[model samples]
Target: MSNNPIPIVDFAPFLDGSAKQQTADQLLGSFKSYGFLYLTNFGISNEEVQEMFDLSKRFFALPHESKMLAPYPEARTHHRGYSFPGREKLPDAGDVAEMPLPSVKETFDIGREDDDSMLNVWPPDHILPGFKELCLAFYWKCHEVEKNILRALALGFGLEEEWLVRHHRMPDNNLRLQHYPSIPLESVLTKKVARISNHTDYASLTVLFQDNVGGLEAEDPNEPGRYLAVSPIPNSVVVNAADFLRRWSNDVIRSPMHGVRAPQDMVTEDGMLPDRYSIPYFCAADFSTVVDTIPGTWSADYPKKYEPMSVGKYMLKRLADGY
Candidate 1:
């Protein structure tokens, strides 16, 4: 209900190269400070955003049997397809044992159509006409925007513009459509369960589009246990640093710990919180790319903080942990 705690950064200037340096500075500053920022004019239109939300609702509304046609594979590295509610056990503050609840959400995941490293699972065309075409188009749209953001980040880090972009040329990203169903608020308030437990993402960066029924929160960097509300702003997308970037930056950038809970105003007279929807495009590098501290991020005074790992191996480990 209060004003959004995260800073807003316009991506138009970055696109036009008019105020690119200033924009890059602000983007990087927000990342280092809050690990999140609101992005506007990032090339995707409000109509397109709403369309995706509509598609997500339609997908989630399908019968359980119908939806299960494209089941989330058991293979640790196979992340595409539909996953039912309670399928994920998200960690709280990096510790899964501390959380008693399973994430009460269902998800539909998609990946690059041309990504030869892994194939995406999809419902039959008759099950959802035009679904694949539209989703694939939107996936690439997100890809283009994220590529530009990476370029700007490279500029902010004082590296060659192509330094970060080159590793991501394969577009091995994941597009996730998440739906949190209405549930009794008391369970969450009592800490017996949660819509989503606190945890940081595993991607290099995440571009999130959330609907106005807000419950999303970002942890306060200065106050360990405190969380600040990230209210939805019309037509704006939220961008955040994620774990891979944290490792790559050698702690120069932070991967924010965030989660969704029941929003006070949205709770009904019967004590059920309304369902919420979000579309997050998680950006990742090519599977074969070996991620280590970037050129300017380490030195004798602050040595490399993490061991080098290939994206494929890292993803497999993280995905295995989530379930």
Candidate 2:
């Protein structure tokens, strides 16, 4: 595995503000160097994290037909909604045609659950009581964790604690619930390439809450032949920066590219049932925000390196291909 290893930052102090500046300094080092980290010790509780994972398991357990009722094709939510395993594509890949075999997975892409404007398409009330409420709570909690990390990131960058976060007000965000069907050791896995293949997320940072069973890998850019397994650190949110952030940082940080290959034990509800779950929260700037050069982030020699981009358009395009 190449790319200098992704750093690790202990957030326990940042959450409590003990040696606050010190914590911020640690954050700066990781973001500036690798743009990815395994953050152990934050304010979010294990029970809360478990609750979110459980909710996702329940949601993804529904019959395939039942989950398909809420497609985003006509909803016009910038193409956001419940996505079947094969319906979505990674924007960077550009291989949108159907594959001989479909993805052995299912998912629900959700954002700000409590915000009235961002309502999720639900299975009828009779089918699931209190489901939406639970998801909303999870979203809110993840948002809290995300904010704490962002503040730490801002301070690490030698800026006001709130400097980086303010741009995310009414943030561009999504909480995804993924269920990778378990496969047998001997069987060749089946997969369909979506147009948005193998790409880095475009958000400022992504927080992944993974289960003990691991498959998440970061492609080693320096040595494409190998992959570094991102081992699950119980209760820790695995955060990584996107291309936009690396560009904003004037290439100081690395925007990694990764993907989910077939899991080893995915039965219908293996990850969605009594056990197995991996949930990730992606955070982005509000669509209206300008994602040009990050303020005070450039020098005369590196003056404003990027063209201005509408937060929504840049991301919408990424999502169109994959995010």
**Distance from true position, residue 52, model 1, in Å?**
0.6
Candidate 2 wrongly placed segments (more than 4 Å): 1-5, 74-80, 91-103, 113-119, 184-197, 221-225, 262-276
True-structure RMSD, every candidate: 1.5, 4.4
Give stretches of model 1 more than 4 Å off: 1-3, 94-100
Residue pairs with clashing backbones, model 1: none
For residues 1-323, could you state the per-residue lDDT of candidate 2 as single tens digits?
24437667788888777777898787767666555678888777899888777777777777777677765444434444567665554433313363333334567777774455556666666555787677767877788887887788777777888987888888568887777654442332323332123557776788888887766667665676465667676667788888777776767667877665444444344333123467878888777787667666788876866778787777766765432
Q: Lowest-scoring 10 consecutive residues by lDDT in candidate 1?
A: 92-101
Q: How accurate is candidate 2 locally (lDDT)?
A: 0.67
**Where does the lowest 10-residue lDDT sum fall in candidate 2?**
188-197
Write candidate 1's Cα lDDT for 172-278 as tens digits: 89999999988899988887778888889997999999998999899989887789898898879999999999888998998989989779999899999898999
Identify the candidate with maximal TM-score. Answer: 1
Q: Tell me the deviation in Å of residue 267 in model 1.
A: 0.5
